[model samples]
Target: MFFGSRKGSEHNSGQDKVISMDRFRDGSSLSPIRQAEAYWTALRQGEDVPKRSQIDPRGLENILSQTFILERIAPGIARFRLAGQKLNEMAGMEVRGMPLTAFFTPTARKQVSAALEHMFDAPAVVELSLQTEATRNRPSQEARMLLMPLRSDLGDVSRALGVFVSEGNSMKTSQRFNVTATELRPVTPLLKPKMSPASKSPNEVNAGFAETQAKFSDEPSVMDEARALVEASRQSMDEARKSLSEIGKPTEKTKPSRSSHLRLVVSRD
Candidate 1:
């Protein structure tokens, strides 16, 4: 009951713009793949990758059964953190916690791992065409799968949004798919907004400090005041020198001769 598988088929791999649903034929059974992609794209809203938390199942109501979320545990390896009913039916059991490679043939597992690595490393969008072989009681089936990078709550590109849709009758047994073609589209990050300069104020001084209220004046500078003080000091020093010179010289020796010629009387004490 597995999907169709063929050997020696060339894989069509390319880098292109975001895929458009209109590019596929109208009423294609794999349209759900494109629908899921479209939902992820809309969530991007100009971002390189949409946040995993931004994913709302309500937006994907129509294709919810085919959508799953993946958490990258290592390079070239990812496991299903959340899977839809279709995946469970394909695996004939709950597919949660299972590696994505489980859904692919052993030979195709390498290709699937490479695709997962590219989607997470390049942070690109990936689409794969899968085919499963028919058994005696089952018919061959064709499927389309989409993997889009998403940012986790921590802003790391460790999570992905995926959709897997197959065209054919439901299988009672577990199934696996073979990679036939792959398309990779590298994403462009959004540019940050630039900051504008602050507007100039009439007053040159900044407004917050206490000095903001001080006015500019044309008063003498500090050098001018220093020169005036020096001149005053020099004058005082010159006057003090002259006064000392006068005191040092002989002064008015004959002025008190007449009145000072007093008789000297010796008195017994």
Candidate 2:
């Protein structure tokens, strides 16, 4: 379960440049913090954020459970949010259920965990900063974060849509950036979108059902709305004219399914 959801922007979308904040290169234009927000806005608008099912692995669900999509996934731990290519060369691995503390320098670990805790406890989108020693020998590195909550069918905080951005200056005469700061934000499950149900079965209320779902509505959070969507999805998938009257379309197909929250994935060397 990806904590934050969105797709990749591997293709040159020109949107990346919109958030680059080149003026920050001179330390004269934007604060690293502000730059991160601008970048996040661009990504959210570009529609480049990938969903959990598209990129992240299942083992991410454990620590992910304690967090909603509106919460931060933290800096050191393996993060499930699908981000852009700037982090491509980034390399690390995770052992399921491990707290992020085990993966960072002492100072980095302490500061980051606290910042993250505050973000989660409040259960709203918040901005926080942290220090890390994970860089290629940099003395001090700052990261910025944006944590926004997503809702499932239960009317509670379910997941989040997040964004992470690093700030830096362009190396003289080159395109390389020497990152000095980073930022993150949660975007989705914020404004509701039409829910796409995984599977549907009618007359089997206790049978396979949607674990999370929601209907399209404004001024509403989806966490509790998932139940309604599940029922609608059930009718849409298995019932004939009922759905046609609701959606003006005929039923497709409904199949039995179950939820798998976590699993291990091995790769061949």
| RMSD per model, one decimal | 18.2, 35.6
Model 1, TM vs. native:
0.59
Best-matching candidate per lDDT: 1
Residue-level lDDT tens digits of model 1 in 52-144: 999998888777888999999988999999998988888888989999999999999999999888998888999999999878988788888
| Regions of candidate 2 where Cα sits further than 4 Å from its true position | 1-81, 91-104, 134-139, 167-269
* Worst ten in a row by lDDT for model 2: 169-178
Model 2 Cα shift for residue 99 (angstroms): 6.4
lDDT of each: 0.83, 0.41
lDDT of 2 by residue, 1-269 (tens): 11322336556443333244455444534343354334334434334242322324232232222222332344323234343332322213322333433434554555555545544444444554544454453544455445443433444433444443444322211111222333333434335455343334232243335443444355556865887898888877777766557886666888968877888899998
Q: Give the Å error, residue 197, model 1.
A: 28
